[model samples]
Target: MRLEHDLAVRREARDIIADDVAIGVGDGWQHLVGRALVTIRDVTDGKVNARQIKERQGLLSIFTDIMIRGSETIAQRVFDVTNGAADQSAWVCEMCGCGGRLIAGNRLRVRCQVCEADEPERERVWREHRDDILEAAATYIRVCLEHSRLFPVYNIVIRVCLDDRDHRLFLDEVHDRLVWWRAGSWIEGVEDALRQDFRRLDFAR
Candidate 1:
């Protein structure tokens, strides 16, 4: 699938992504949430099933959240999946089949650190993920995001892979939020911000 930086291009590209997306519609892009989102869906039921538990019932703000921070490779893959129909992402950069990062600039996109670094940074965008590694490393999956009408919009669902870190979630530099996250909606603004980030991909632009 083609991922573009131009808002018009992205607008047209949705038709292509929607062709593959099972649900279609921007909000209907549930399949893109990936395994992480799936885990969240399974756990919270996205309120579709029933309210069982939450990290908090309120909100907590993290100074920073570069989608799985400290790990550029995973971030790039997430970008590829969301922006490019990169089904084969497999926790690896879908472009070079190596590792990379998600660049948030004029447009949300991903590229290899080795090859695409020289590319001009056009269109205000956001990009992260540095450190260099040779071979593929272990996967570091983060919270699964859900598309819900709930004010928070993006409901985070974390899955424990044998290590669910013992049903706990550790953040980048924000270690304190971890406690607030598992407690319940730590605060509404937090989710609202997250949803805003997720919403970046939902428009014609």
Candidate 2:
């Protein structure tokens, strides 16, 4: 969900959700989650505790471990409500909350017709421009590493010995880029390209 929406739900259901718990969902299921939390709260009379709220296998997954001041029947009802909400999310778009269908493949996603339709074009564009995007990423990372401006946030794993000089330099450069910097106007363009590349790359599988 969006930060604002997440914050709103957290604020509204302060007593039910843990402080560190993250609602791992998109804007589309905001109401479903909000309603579920509210219903759970009302049903348990402000005595339930939710430890996790996330999307699991393209469906809503809410994990609640405690319900104080509730009978066995009430507890069962709570479970039914949570499960029902999760099941309902199967048809709800995770991005826009519109009616959606689960797209089964390498990764599961619940997306509406519009969002699903856009995926192919995104993948097509990424595939056509793959080399350019990769070169930009490499240039950005190399520049950042050489100038000690910043480190790459994403990478492919490397198998290097602990005492390798190249590995040590890579680690040192990575550590130095943790702080904010005026990386450059070019940084924005490179970052945007990299984001698009990374997002569309998942569809290739």
Candidate 3:
């Protein structure tokens, strides 16, 4: 298989395993075992039978081991799988509420700290530069669309207060331009985004 194909398969497998781990965590081990059996049957096209339970048991054990080693590993694997698929990480400042490198030097402060300290002055400047707020909103939308594979879009829409019509429009626009070109297929990224709940891929929200 090609590298992309392999990565895609890994991503799918990881997602499936993650779901199983979640079920196992939420319900009981017996429920996990039952779900595993169902999953094996589904994956194997009903070829898995009573005799295969032992093998499935072993598979489950290995999966649990890998999962227990680190939860973040699975998360990072998903991140790696979707890396470079979108531009999602860029962010504006919180304290100063400025875009493009709000902090300077080693201080890591949002503002220069030398200027705009007074509350009234800060509010006045922010109000005068309302365009910056709009720009930030646009950038936020762009990032949300770009990194949507990391979370589900439905959740994102809810979290971001985007209406269904606007959400679909955003998806269609991104699908037509950036997503299609990058994935070499219109549906792959869209489908993945839908499957992953449109998690933002660029950066943690």
Name the candidate that leads on lDDT: 2
Writing each residue's lDDT as its tens digit, candidate 1 over 1-205 gives 1111122222333322221122211111223223323333333323221111111111111111324342565445434433343332322432333554555565444456742453443111112211100000001102223332212111232232233322221211122222223223233234434533332443222
**Over 4 Å off, model 1:** 2-32, 49-97, 104-108, 113-205
Instruction: Estimate the TM-score for candidate 1.
Output: 0.20
Choose the strongest candidate by TM-score.
2
Instruction: Write down the lDDT that model 2 would get.
Output: 0.61
Better of 1 and 2 by TM-score: 2
Counted clashes in each candidate structure: 27, 2, 13
Is 1 or 3 the stronger prediction by TM-score? Answer: 1
Report the error of model 2 at residue 180, Å: 19
Span of 10 residues, lowest total lDDT, candidate 3: 19-28
- Give the better candidate number (2 or 3) by TM-score: 2
Model 2 misplacement above 4 A? 67-70, 118-205
Candidate 2 lDDT, tens digit per residue, 1-205?
A: 4334565677678778764566777768888888898889888887878877878988988888655557898789789989999889999998778999999977788999976765565455455544444444455455544454432333422423244543433332222221111111133334533333322121111
Residue 95, candidate 3: alpha-carbon lDDT:
26
What ranking emerges by lDDT with the best candidate at the front? 2, 3, 1
Compared with the true structure, model 2 gives a TM-score of: 0.56
